[model samples]
Target chain A: MKLTLRVWRQKNADAPGAMAAYEVDGVSPDMSFLEMLDTLNEDLIVQGEDPVAFDHDCREGICGACSLVINGDAHGPERTTACQLHMRSFRDGDTIDVEPWRAAAFPVVRDLVVDRTALDRIIQSGGYVTAPTGSAPDAHAVAVPKPDADHAFVHAECIGCGACVAACPNGSASLFTAAKVNHLNVLPQGAPERESRVLDMVAQMDAEGFGGCTLAGECATACPKGIPLQAITTMNKEWLRAARTSKR
Target chain B: MSWTSCGWPPYGRRMALATRDRRPPTVRTLWDSSVGKKTVMAVTGLIMLGYLVAHMAGNLKIFFGADEFNGYAHWLRHLGAPVLHSHWALWIVRVGLVVSVVLHGVCAFQLSRRDIKARPVRYAHTKARTSYATRTMRWGGVILALFVVWHLLDLTTLTVNENAQAGHPYENVVATFSTWYGNVVYIVAMLALGLHIRHGFWSAAQTLGVGSAARARLLKGAANLLAAGLTIGFISVPVAVMTGVVN
Candidate 1:
């Protein structure tokens, strides 16, 4: 298959970027989106031209490292991650536009690579349990309710690919923050610091200069992990509970 | 949980206290986020929606006759009389509504500016994933605002009402709706209001943390019912006047 790719190119974060067009032929339907990019890079190397730079790791899609907005969607037309998107999704002679995750917090590092440290900062603020290293506890020691465990596991599936932030019109990290908040806050292990966890994570999220959640709900639609939009509502509930109960 | 060197410092004792102390007062912090503004919008919107329902119920008295409608309107101003004073309850309600409207507008405007600032570079080819009501909320709000001004001038103050009659609420309402332009404006504004409430109620549920996956369907149904019922309720008077049913 032949395809025209208009990929965003930039020298660095401070440099101006624009859409650079390239034509690639002999594409196989089985080739994953990243594999197609690899072929394009090989062709570019042969021509002594600079290849497009995009972030990808563990091409199997679990690592959440691949970030590309294809044809205006966070992870292309499919609800799956960029690494999982195959060339067969597009027809022959198609023009695909690819760009980095655009957000005020996620600045373009180079070409399709963006600095997603803001997401890391939010996690750092309070996305984890406070349990210290020790012998593993018996599985039945906590005895979490089935429904709460199920809900927590569902939210725990988030891969933090920054798609939620990228896809949000407001660049809000509400979905991402909510996923982390609910995943732990629902479990008995995370109950000790639940209130403070919501407060600190939300504060850090705000400090990172991310936008607010307008309930536009594009983040959930763009989410490759299938993170439910209701996670945000749950987080809001947690925040409200914490805000009212906490002394501070 | 396994610990990895992910570049961020671990959540430590001092760090938690430091973060907590650094946080501003609860109210200031609450108003700082988009979520905060949305909460304000949702609460205030509910307040206004309540007033609308009550007002609509009052307006339905027009069907009973001139005495019933005028007497109902008269009763609105005279409620709590002898115990309090004439128009005191009405003025309190008016003041509450004005405050809600102002706060809702300010929060909406600020949140819009923030949303625009978040994405400096627009998408070349965009695909909408939200509902039409959600997308058109700002425009719907503007329509409702303009309608409120016109409605007040035409009916409340009798400034824009050409066939204005003093002290006769029923005649004033009928005279205003009797005009073709008046009907058009009222009907159009009612439609906008319906759309606004449709999205606003569901959104308010989510923002106020009252909605859940199990109850989403119920909440949506209620929103639809409220929007449809209110639109029909408010438009019935103008339609009745235009059709000579109330004349």
Candidate 2:
């Protein structure tokens, strides 16, 4: 297959970025999207030109490291990560436009590589339980209701790929934050710091300059992990409860 | 080791508590974020929706005749009688509605501005993942705002109603709807209102955390019913006047 690629290229954080077009031939349908990019990079390197910079660690979808907005949809048309999206999703002679995640909080580090440290900061603010290291507790020691446990496990699947932030019109991280909040807050061990967890994480999310959730729900749709939109509502309820009931 | 065993609190918890001390009161903090603004919009929107339901029921009194319609309007002022002065209850409701409207409008405006600021660069090829009503919320809100002013001027203040008399609400309603422009304005606004309510109610339920997987379908159904009911109810008054069923 032959394809035309419009990929955003930036030298560094301070450099201005623009869509640079490249044409590559002999692309295999079996190749992954990143593999296709690797082909282009190899061709560029052979010509003594600069290679395109993109972030990818584990080629598997679970790493959440591969972030790309393919044809304006985050991760691609499929509800899966960009790394998992095969070239067959596109037809031969197709023109693909790839861009980095665009959010005020997520600055471009290089071509198609935006700094997602904003998400890390939100996690650092209080996306954890205070359980100490020791002998592992009996699995049955904490009997979480089946429904709650199922809900928490579903939320715990969020990979933090920043696709939700990318797909959101408002660029809100509510879905991401909600996933972390609900994941920990629903469990028995997570209850001790529940009130403070929501408050601190929410405050940090706001400080990061991400837009508010309008319940637009695009984030959930774009999420590669299939994180439910209800995660956000759960977090909102948690925040309301904390704001009302917290002593401080 | 546990955080306490180290003779210190966890770093994140310590920072959170420290920040809480420097932060403003809970109410102010809640008002400062996008989530906070959304909560205000959802709560106030529900309040206005409540009024719409009641107002629609009152407007239906017109179907019974002038005496009943006029009586219903009169009863509004005399509500809470014997315990409170005449019009006191009405005034309280009016004030509450006004406050809710103001908060709803201000929050929506600020949140939109913030949304725009969040995305400075436009996407090369954008795909919409939301519904049409959700996209039209901002413009729908503007139309509703304009309609409210016109509605009050024509009905509440009697400033735009050509045949408006000081104390005859039923007659005033009939007179206004009898004109072509009145029906046009009312119908257009009602359409916008229908779209607004359909999206607003569902959005409010999500914001208020009133829907779960089990109840999601029911909440959405209720939102649709409310939107359709209120739109038809409000539009029926003008349609009846236009057809000379009520004069």
Candidate 3:
């Protein structure tokens, strides 16, 4: 398949970026989106032209490292990470637009890579359960109910991909923050620091200059992990409860 | 279990002296957070929503003719008269409503600016966002604000209302709705109000942390009901006048 790619390119973080079109010939339909990019990059290297820069690691869709707004969708037209998105999803001779995640908190670092360290700072604020630094405890030591464990696991799927922020018109990180909060807040082991976990993480999220949740559900739509929008409501509930009851 | 539930940071509390030196997070500090601002919007919006329901119900009194409508208007000023002075209860409600409106508008303005700033750049390929009512909320709010001004001038102050007279609210309402521009403005604003409430009511519930997947359908149904009921109820007055049913 020969296709036209309008890929965003920038020299560095301080440099301006624009869509630079490149034509790739003989692209196989079985190649992943990143592999297709590899094809284009090889040709660019052969011609001594600077190849487009993007983020990718693990390439298995779990690292949350690949951040691309392909064809206006977070990962692509499909519901998976960019690395897992195959070229078969597109028609032959199609034109694709590739760009970085758009959010002030997740500013574009170069091409399709945005600094998502803001999310790490939010997790630092409290996204954890308290345990002494030692060897792992017995799995059955703490008995969490089945429903609660399911709830925790459901939300724990968030990969910190920042697609929620990219898809959100407000560029809000509510879904990301909610997933982190709910993943731990539902477990028996997590019950100890539940209140502070919510409060501090939410405060950190706000401090990072991320936008507020408007409940538009775009975040959930773009999320590759299928983190439910209800995660946000749960976070809101936790935050409110903490605000009212937690001594802090 | 967690640091003896002192609400202090457990790791820091290991010092035993840190508890005395550290300040706990309070509602005061929380208010400065974006979440708190949203709470303010949610609360104020519910206040206004409640008032709109009552306002629409009161407007329905027009169907009972000038006596019931005029009597209801008169009763408003005399509300709580035995204990509270004449117009005192009315003034209190007026003040409360003013406060609600001001706070709601201020928070909406600030949050909107922040929301826009958070997403500084736009994607090259854009897609339409959310529902029409959801996307149009900001402009709908602005339109409602301007409409409130016209409504007050036409009804409350008896200014801009050409055929206005004192103490005859039924007649004044009829006169206001009697004109072409009046009907046009009233209908348009009422439509905007419906769209606003459709999104705003559900959004307020989410912001207040009362919404969940289980309650989502119920809350949405209520929002639609309220939006439809109020719009139709309020627009009935202008329709009544235009059709010479009230006049």
Please give the RMSD to the true structure for each candidate, in Å. Answer: 3.1, 2.6, 3.5
Q: How do the residues B1-247 of candidate 1 rate in per-residue lDDT, one tens digit apiece?
A: 1343343365442233223344566676578766667788999999999999999988999999999999999898998888869999999999999999999999988877777777788766577777888888988998998899898898888999888887898999989888889999999999999989999999899988998989999999999999999999999999899889998
- Taking all chains together, each candidate's TM-score versus the true structure is 0.94, 0.94, 0.94
Q: Is candidate 1 or candidate 3 better by TM-score?
A: 3
Model 1 off-target regions past 4 Å?
B1-25
Which lDDT tens digits does candidate 3 get at residues A1-248?
99999998887889998998999998998999999999999999999998888999999999999999998999999999999999999999999999999999987888877899888878767887768767988888888889998999999999999999999999899999999889998887888878778877777787788988877889999999999988988888888788778763
| Chain B TM-score of every predicted model | 0.91, 0.91, 0.90
> Which is the leading candidate under DockQ?
2
| Each prediction's fraction of true contacts recovered | 0.50, 0.58, 0.59
lDDT of 3 by residue, B1-247 (tens): 4453566443431222212333366667456767878888889999999999998999899999999999999999999979999999989999999999999899889888889989999999888869999998999999999999999999999899999998999999989888889989999999999999999999989888898889999999999999999999999999998888998
Candidate 2: DockQ? 0.53
Q: DockQ for all models, in order?
A: 0.50, 0.53, 0.47
Per-residue lDDT for A173-200 in model 2, tens only?
9999999998999998899879888988
The sequence of per-residue lDDT tens digits that candidate 2 reaches over residues B1-247 is 3443453444442334323444457788679867878999999999999999999988999999999888889888899998989999999999999999999999999989888888778788776668988898999999999999999999999998888998899999999988889999999999999999998998999888877878889988998999999999999999999888988
